[model samples]
Target: MPMSEQRYLVAARKYRPQLFRELVAQEHVTETLKNALRLDRIGHAYLFSGPRGVGKTTAARLLAKAINCQTPLDQREDGAEPCRRCEACLAFEEGRSLNVLEIDAASNNRVEDVRELRETVRIPPQGARKKVYIIDEVHMLSNAAFNALLKTLEEPPPHVLFIFATTEPHKVLPTILSRCQRFDFRRIPVENIVARLREVCAAEGVEADDESLMLLARKGDGALRDALSAFDQAVSLCGTRLRYAELAQALGVVDIDLYFQVTEHVRTGNGAGMLQLVERVVGAGYDLQEFVIGLAEHVRNLLVARTLPDLSLIEAGEATRRRYAQVAEAFTEADLLRMLGLLAEAETALKQSAHPRLRLELTLLRLASLPHAVDLRRVLEQLDRLAQSAPEAPAAASSSAAADPSRGRTAGLSRLSTPTGSTTPQPAAPGSNLGSGPFGPPALQVRPSEKPGDSLAQATQSAAALMVAEAPEASFETLVSRWADVVQQIKQVRIHVGLLLEESRPLRLMHDTLELAVPGEHAERLLRNQETFLITQLHAHLSEAISIRRIRFVVQDRSVAATSAALPEEPEDPLELLRRLQQQVPALQQLIDRFGCEPLWQGN
Candidate 1:
């Protein structure tokens, strides 16, 4: 092959898209541009803005060629494409077209440059019908220069066109932006870039695996030009026989295995393996921050793979994608989210840290040690299922859960207290058990009649029920008739409360409030101590029985009448009570004699 026939072209330039239809990942811009050209509704100025290497300037060039191509078919239905064989297209491709000019705004951003441009715009294209000027990084233009060109850009000669391209569109003057039809270019997807790379490789007769191509695509960070450049470097390093290992090593990239190993270490709780992986990466001389970034990406891949159905969003080979999906199953979406968060924090901190390697190691350790964030809703659902299957024994389950090793602290998802949204505790239902379990109280027995060794809760519930039924409101006389029954019921429910009640004389009944005359302050104190509980029981007894919603207990000072009514005819000494108990209950006398018990407390 002759030198003229066989030419050398780098991947970036050799494969650059020349037509509106050929530009990658810019359909919105291309479709609109083609429609505008087809409709002959061309604007005087157009703005193309996006991140670097995402076809901004390229789209501008293609637009210029599409409009300037001389072939009659070029402007037909199969239009918006440059006839590359035409003089206009040929000259434009060679960068020698007098009809089109590309100015680097970073270098020529002064007011004088704008003046020169204005002067040039006045002259028609020497070869083509219209002249187009492409200003790259137009945001670099000085304010004065932007102002100088604003009028010309807004209403240029009919034969002139201006195209502005910028990564930072916000920095461009609002006046200039208003004068142009702006098009935003998006970052090309990694899959698209990889597909393009595969085409390039086949055309070049080079052998590259999917993993190698995937890695190259991700290295581009959504920039096809950058991905091509990286691909070119890979080709240069290994001369087209592209093995993933050599390509990765030549680029000094952390191998995918390291990230995989890091995740595996996290799954298995192996901090040491992660540390060794770091050592291997450091020994290879890769940047720790870069490693952290890659780890974050790895976690991101897992997250998307786990949570989303579209595997195309993940940039990896089929095998790698399968592995990601598999590992993703081991991790919940919440776990992957937590992992990404930790890695991102580490990556950010590494930028500000004095010791990046140590920070990275700490991050790795943290990730490896992260207790998987389990979804509490799912855990609760499982617990509910278990509860239903076994028996309705929350009390026993709760007690057992307190002592059960399996119930202690679950890994991955630790216990978290959630708001039950209830203000007061609800008592157990009539026949249901409270907290009965192997570790809790026995099943609550709803006996028809009271039996020996019944739980206090059951007995209290029974007494409360009986009190509700029998303690009805009546006139003072009827109420006084039931006072002894109230005392007896209280004695059965609680001996101490009943004893305190025994020291009060019913003075008067005023509505639901029971005004009691107490013999002394000692009895009054006891009543006040159990006031809330006593009132609940009293209201339960009195409420529906009377029309009372609440019942109040009031104790007044002992008058002679109250003292006389409340005081039982008895021995004045405490010893007299002991003597009475000894006489009434021989078992109490026997226990007292056996222990040789002495009176520790004496009443006045």
Candidate 2:
């Protein structure tokens, strides 16, 4: 009825691999089947197991054809394959071979089906050497069905060869499994898929770019049938003049360039750029969850490309491979591991998220902002070595300081910042076990509260007098004893005032007032101005409160040139304060000298 009309075959059906050599990435199964046939060692039963669309069924069919080919003598010794020109091959090709039966066990998995199959197995072949029964998705058979078929499977009729193909081999009954020789088929590599697709396109007179072909191959996820399906879809949509953009648009897949750009953004620590890229992805109507998945895969590819020397492991075009190699050099193995771990976490969380776009953006932002993780092992090893060397240090250091209880004098107070532009180590607190060392960080000393008041200072005087009456040792000497504490206390209020106090020492400790000698008048100016603030902090800090009526600042004879008299007897002017500060601190002087620095103050 349709002699004048013809129908077009899909790429998957049209270019299906007919010969063992044509099977992509299934050489193991092909070679074994061919070898078994060559040695006349064809078994009674065979089980093909692997992922879907990865040649499990195809291998089973090919094995069946090879076993029953009319020209068995033609491939008697080696390279055994069905000659398609022969009677049996032609019958199989035309789907009219009574000897070869393919059953979708998913639709026929019942005890009755097994009983019917058992009855069919008892019959002998008419023309072929044996009758082949291929059961696809054999695991779908019910337990009763499996049990019913077990006996016949174990000791089948000599002319009947049972071939089972399933994605899940574990679901097959153990009894059934023992009878069948299993062949596990592997996923086709991207290169193999591309190679096969190129041949198909060439034969069909289709024009396609390598990038577009690669996209189709990758979309298949190592399934040649799936790839052909994708290829057919791309060819149909793009009318054989296939471009990468059209293919990507047709498949709704994010381009490799976007993934690389994301990687580049991560490498460069560009969170904004990564966010922008995500915005574009979202605006284009791509699934955020799928994008996250692809990004995770992209990161994995980079990790593999960076770690492995073999480039064949990565599934992409040559330009993409080169880009991966080039970009992979930017991240170390540790960084790649971190990136993968982060992406994995993102992917797992992305699956259940209701707001996937937000989650994806956050994940990408976090990845983009992620600094290369430190090698904790190396750091721990270094710390262990430091700890080992630490015990010997105090022994060497103690000899350079106080020797006996009689000479257990406290070191003078020091400032965090000094006029010489170098930091001085603060004196250790009383009863502290930690001695001064260059290794450890500067210990933090608790300072007085910064609440603005002179109430504490006034209260301290009366308290000190009472304490002195009870214990005569709690006098002006007590005040000088905790002077460093006072400076630490003052530091909390104003670092500059604490620094000013560091340049001076207690000259005379009278009943009430204390005299301090500073090297510069500038130091004297600052100390005079912040006297109340210092005394308030000191009153709160010191254990025994000693009253300080006034802090009398006088210029002491030191190395620096004297500019003016020590005390001008005036609350110093603001401009005069800046001049004095610049004169006292070399850093401040250099700032003015180099950067044309000046003091700018606003008055209320």
Candidate 3:
């Protein structure tokens, strides 16, 4: 039966490294072992740990042969590579070496196996300088077996050596590790794996592209053997011309180009674009989980590239690497971190979800919309534009403050954006120990109520008792101005609140009564929800029983600009409200001109 059928040799079996020099990406482990053998400073037990199929067992076997090489390098008396023609090397390779023992601990993990092994260690080697027992999957041994083997491992004979190889080193007992010299093998890098695979393909006369080799290398997860196995599959599926599409389809993996396109959508905050991309991907029959994993990896690469461009260690083809370099330069570090976090979270959600496609689509939408909504850069840019158009005169800016109750005066108010977008330091409130005096936010002044002047006094005292009133002189305008300031503070707290502030425009104040206008009937209902809190904040700011009333909003269309005449009126220019204020209160006129307060002028 065997003679008639053809035997297909797997790439893993055919390309296994037979000697130290042939091992790829593991020179450190081999060179160190060679040096130890040459110096004759070898330990009784040696532990080799690393990812699967990355030469742990192979290195263990090599060590055994090198120790017993008769015609060794002998620079200091021993050699680098074992002499294959030596009695021990030939006997070892033939599976008939008396002193070289290989045990698969995975299947033989019991106290009885350990007891039998303990007994075998008592006998000496017949032909070699040292008796070597190599145990693979040492981590799989039972706790009882480990305990039973512990004493012999700690104090074995000088002529005996124990080699333990495991994919998981932490699972092995610490007591056993203390008695051995340890070597941890790393996952081979993508470039190194691809190069090795290329050599194997050429030797086998298989034609494959660099892209296909990269996909195989990535699929291997750092194991050379796994990469070779994937290579064999690619050879059968595509017959040596490895195209990226065919390779990914064959292996159930996503292509790199898709990742690049998805990242561009995220950077632009295009939700529709992201959803379209997801629909196309799903329609193409790619697995949602596979796409999620690939997307997460792509974000991770971008983050690495953004944070450490010089130190980024990627294993992609030249074209793909250059594309990554361009993407890295385009995104900021903050954007990358946020994207990575979002994608990682999405990956977990995608796994648990029954409708993974829907979840993926939602995740993409979230990523795409983030750039437009809460980005710090966008907020700062808006504020910068406002600042540029702001008037140079402190008075015009100050009047701008008094004109809009939603923009108030506070010590830190300068850091905030004005309605027009400029940032300017605001006057301190009156009685504010904040180092700026009366021109500051007007002290909690109470507007006099007509109910015998004592009623306003009683209300002011009550407000002060409530800790809302600061001790400041009273005036009707001061109370109105301060209440306006509190409204502005709340506006700054949230944009929705700020929009509400615009809708609730201040109308006028008369005899301890304050009135505001709500833009629409719907807005009036919304304002009612927060009426109680709003009144309390106003009382704290006004220190008076200033009632708030909301009326229908009215539109006022003026031919002349509302802010046109802030300066004193001349004969040629109509003498507006500013001239009138100057006529009635000459002292106020000095204050207005001195502080550069733009005067209100009467239009002809």
Candidate 4:
């Protein structure tokens, strides 16, 4: 092939920024340089440092071209860009400029190289106004080389300018860094990279969609040169036209749809589907680590969608943004956070694991099987609803009692003793009738001729009924007296909270607030966490006598007295202990009767 036919430059080099204004995502560096030129405050030495392929070297070259251009500074476009038609700019463009020297510091990093550069720097410019020395990868220079160049860099000739480019400024000696005006470049944004890719595609006459261009930019991971390189490779592979699906497949990039499928499987708890997805990924030669990374980003986007009112934070096309919004509706932010955490762990593990495929499979399965997190707000809402419906129970009980005079007295007595919302059946007196009601145990009928003093049992029951029926308004004394029953009722609902309450005592009841003295801060925190539930239980048990709207737990230095003092003491004898347990827990008594249980004495 002829030399002219073979002269094809890569997109990265062919589309390199020729002017300061053309540099992408580097406004700070460009604006400062343009102002320096405009104000005639150009420094003797400049250091350009940033990540690889973020226009550090390209900016250096453009600065050199602009400084040596024949056009007057005030007459140049933007007062910074060089006129390509000028002799100095044309020489720089054709890589034949005598004034602008771009040195590869990586290859010439010895002290001898610095001596040679110093000798050359003393020479006057052959044709241009300034002698520009651009050292690429200046950090690769040896310590001796850096020291040798320091004096020249600090006190260069008035017509000479030095520009250094490096990915790592830290590796360069601090003394060398102090001699240069450093301008740190930043990674280009995805939007900016995509816009540049659009321009490149138009120039190359290649048809590409927004999604394909966005994917190419993301695959670049913030480097415009890298994205352009990818754009070249994509054009080569796809032959002048690029679609998202075909480009993703040809590049071995995991499709975004795969990430959505993983989330959908998690939502439905489809572990088998996740396994199948992993199989498909493996069979299709997708990189598990890259998939995990993309999945984490997907979950992060979902979280942003679920939390933020708009999808401004998410970087995707409008169609993909709408999909994220729809999928985010099915998951809470907490769930997405947990998924992201899991993916992060899996990502770390995948790098070190010998069996990455197996690890990925287990991770996906775990994600699918993740238990749905209970929302505390929803639980509180349900509790509020239950509380609102509780007061109606007493009225319904009273109405039933009025309709049946035979059982009216017993029903009224039972209602007075039983707490609202309690399902425990009240023990009946030697009854005339015991029919089961929707609430619990049916009301029992007392004989019309039975007297309160007829027997010891009857007299005790009559006195207890009278006390409960005429109970005084709630006070500190009343709370102390009823604390045992409150703890026992709590045990039926939440045993752990009941145990915590047993170690606490009622300190005082002021207005609607009940204060309890707890042993320590841990206990206080635990009790306070359940304070709302405790208040609900208290209301159910003492709404008729007390108006407890809040319960405050205090961590006091002094020991708290037990709240279960009202419980009967356990007898020493084994048989008596069993009998006491049976009396306290109705289920124990029922078990004993069902099994025909008998106490075994030591001799037996």
Candidate 5:
């Protein structure tokens, strides 16, 4: 706390690895070097490669001391161990080892430095086993320096060992790499980093919680020293125990609970709630990028928890993991995937964007409103629900086919077409009982969308409705395709609708008739709502003289969801499903007339 002691000691250096055993997440490098020393298979030159703060330089020094220790152990022969008590070890610890020469290749990267190094390697050791040269950041050495060092590296004296360490090993000459025994190091995993941080904290006598420790470990990003430095700051900032708020404020990280609340709101299709939460988060003055990263991570957790179902493997703490599990339970797998994709895209936007706040808010808004989007699954689920809840309106069915003149049913009402030239057939719902009991045979023949008794005049009315919904477009094909794309966009926000939409395929592109076939009648109602608006928009967007005369909703007899539950439960959004059906099938002019039942398909 004194003025002199107040000088900043970056987290990186304060916890720099001083001993081989102190190194984190580079056991392969350390163990291999220790083995070489123990086995006397020490190569003339060694290459240590990995990311920064991952012990490349530290490993180099440790190798140097082990090789040239004054009282070098037979440990490599015994078991790859270093003798810490020897004079050479003592000298190396003091940075005054006679035989161990450490060079920063960055500053001294000229040919002259290589020349001097070459001369030094030839003299052999005055007091150690070998004249060991340690070059840190050898990638920074000049081309000439590399070439000058190559020859000696190829055939150094038996008593000389060259150890080169580099964060960017690719920058080091290939010739240099090939000549040495390469040992690759990797960035420590978060778990390893946390363990190391705990060790450091214990040594420093700082009391810390798992959450705060995990935060520090994440901040380290595999760097033990960085985590320790952050730990030091956290300890200083909040004394012994670190509060989540203090950790967030000190680290510029958003509160985990904010992320929890926001993601929870998103799961339930609460756009207003999400917006309110976002306003609060932004008002807290948190960096938008940080929040974006956290949101992406939060979504990712939900995704993994939903799919994997193994909380132990996840990288969050118990509290965070529980929160993720709860959120994951609320969402379907597809929902989480869509949100994750959105968050990821938003992360990119945040990075490239100058206005992070705007990007963040927009991303949050997109996620919050995603449930309103149409998805194939949602559409399918809606169809299933409609089949379950809708009663057998036998008279309504007979009247429906009898009323539309341009429509007719064939093959026992398997297929139906309206008088407007729509040939889509409405299929029976998966578990809908056509007979006496649930899932029984067809007791009352489910009539098609078009009636056999529909006179020409009545057919004209049905056709007129279809034409009114269809707007003028340049090409019916383009209109329908673009409509499908919009439905797909809707699906991006609504997974259930997206699924059902995927099932409803377009059959025919008539002049004023768009023929679409769905798996069942439930899909018919789904296509009815946006049926008119989409037709209008299609005409407007393409500017063609194509009218969406009718969305022919024909059902396929086979139930896609039959393999699972007996009855399909209603999805959250049914209107989107109807739009999907209409977009997928333009010929089914009477989707609303057929499956537009109450409770399931809310008329929009």
Candidate 6:
């Protein structure tokens, strides 16, 4: 290489913004400074603060050059942009200007440095109207240095100007900050970064596609300098041309396709596919935590896509945006939220787990195995359809019927009335629990193979049967025998009320009124709050058995005799108890058979 050969300058430095308009995504700060320059409102001290690589330091440098330029503000075309041909601007651009000094506060952050700065502030500008001092990373200055500079910063010479730039404004001394005109910069959007990269590529005669530029922008994570640095790296790796695949590979970025594949496996419930994806991720030498992070972002994108009509919130290329929209159709918003939550947990776990690969595999498998969430709207629509197809029953009759037919003697039996006014039970379907029974049908029987609509239709029929069925007359013994059914019915409506009822017992039964005993006043009060609901449920369940007009609750003493003495003793044998239950409630036998429930007995 010859010494005279042109030296390569990195994109970050080579394309640094020299003018206010050239600074990307910082209009708020730039416009304010430009207005101030046009109005000749130059402040003695200024501060710029924001995230890294978001043009804080660049804005500070631009403001310094503009204020010190020999070109008069009224004569300049842009008003704020310095004339590069002028002696002051040319000297500053060439880094030989004695009037404009840029200092790295990170290295020279001691009390002596502030003392030296104070000494230099007294000297007048040689060739420019103002001597500008731009301090980068001003927060790095120690407390003593900050205290030493505070007085000078607050009341410096009219010819001296101080500009401070820092990523962390909170770390800067409040006293020193109060003296400066503060301007906060914002993170550059992905679109703006991509557009800037495109300009860079065009200027350098390098060819790059949209996807490649998007990848670089996203890799930068809201920082223009970082994105530009990534662009430089991509150009170095791929010569004059850059594509998405090679650029991603060279930069060790996990391809967005892998994230899509993970979600696809989840949609299909393919645990094996998830395992293979994890294996591929590991084989590619991708960090498990980083992969989880990327997957979380992918899930977030899907969530946004599923919830919003357009992809305005997403920052992917047009093709990738279309893919997100297409994939989002397969998932509900709830499912995407759950996936994101799971991925977030996995991300945290991967940070602390020794076996990251195994953790990642377990996480992906869990995501794949996640049950599809049942949409309440769809269920309600199905119910509405079923309701429309079924015959309408009287509202008063339906109100008196049991809500759930599964717990009564007439669990699955449906009945039809003859013209002669006699009711006859409909023949039961083969392999169904429904049959001719003493009581009418509680609910219609549904098979596992039936669609959701069919099941809803059967349910509607069961409800109709419950509404029309005649209540059979019974003795007090029947009410006692059906006490558990009444409690279960209450549980289905309000579980806490049912649980409270479970703790109480029947003390005695009057001609038209019943008195129950509870263990404590708290239980009595809680039950009292639901007295009306309890009364309605009791009337619906034991209307034929008993005609109780009013019910009273009493607190029983702990030392009192057990309430079990009032009711019949349950059979000691599990088989005998089960048989007795089936005899009292035929539906219990069907439930036991359908669910394969085994009877277990506890010995006293």
- TM-score, per-candidate, Cα-based: 0.63, 0.62, 0.62, 0.67, 0.64, 0.68
lDDT of 4 by residue, 368-415 (tens): 877544433332343335334433333454466577767523334344
Where does candidate 2 clash, by residue pair? Answer: none
User: lDDT score of model 1?
Assistant: 0.74
Cand. 4 TM to true fold: 0.67
Better of 2 and 6 by lDDT: 6
Model 3 regions more than 4 Å off: 1-8, 75-78, 267-269, 305-312, 328-330, 373-604
Score candidate 4 by lDDT: 0.79
As for TM-score, the candidate ahead, 1 or 2, is 1
Candidate 5, residue 124: lDDT: 66
Model 6 worst lDDT run, 10 consecutive residues: 433-442
Supply candidate 3's per-residue lDDT for 33: 83
- Sort the predicted structures by lDDT, highest score first: 4, 6, 1, 2, 3, 5
Kindly provide the TM-score of model 5 when superposed on the true structure, using C-alpha atoms: 0.64
The TM-score of predicted model 2 comes to: 0.62
Which ranges in model 4 have alpha carbons more than 4 Å from their true place? Answer: 1-6, 383-604
Model 2, residue 412: distance off in Å is 23
Task: Supply every candidate's count of residue pairs whose N, Cα or C atoms clash at under 3 angstroms.
Answer: 3, 0, 16, 0, 65, 2
Cα displacement (angstroms), candidate 4, residue 294, comes to: 1.0
Relative to the unseen true structure, what is the C-alpha lDDT of residue 8 in candidate 5, on a scale of 0 to 100? 70
For candidate 5, lDDT tens digit of each residue in 132-167?
Answer: 788888899989888988788898888888888888
Tens digit of lDDT per residue, candidate 3, span 1-604? 5876967779887676767888889989988887787677888999999999899988988889888877747532235787788788898887898898899999989999999989989898897889999999999999999999999999998889999999999999998899899999999998889899889888988777777888899999999998888888888888867888888888878777789889887765567888888888988889888888888888777766666655337667777766787787667666678777888888888778988888998888877765321232332343344345433424444465566767422211222223245333243342233211211222223344423333322322223322222222234355545645766776655445445555356665532344566544444566667666665666666655444432233333221233334544754444455575454433344456656987655555
Candidate 6 residue pairs in clash (backbone atoms < 3 Å): 410-442, 413-441
lDDT of 6 by residue, 229-271 (tens): 9988898899999999998999999998999999988877789
Highest TM-score against the true fold, candidate: 6
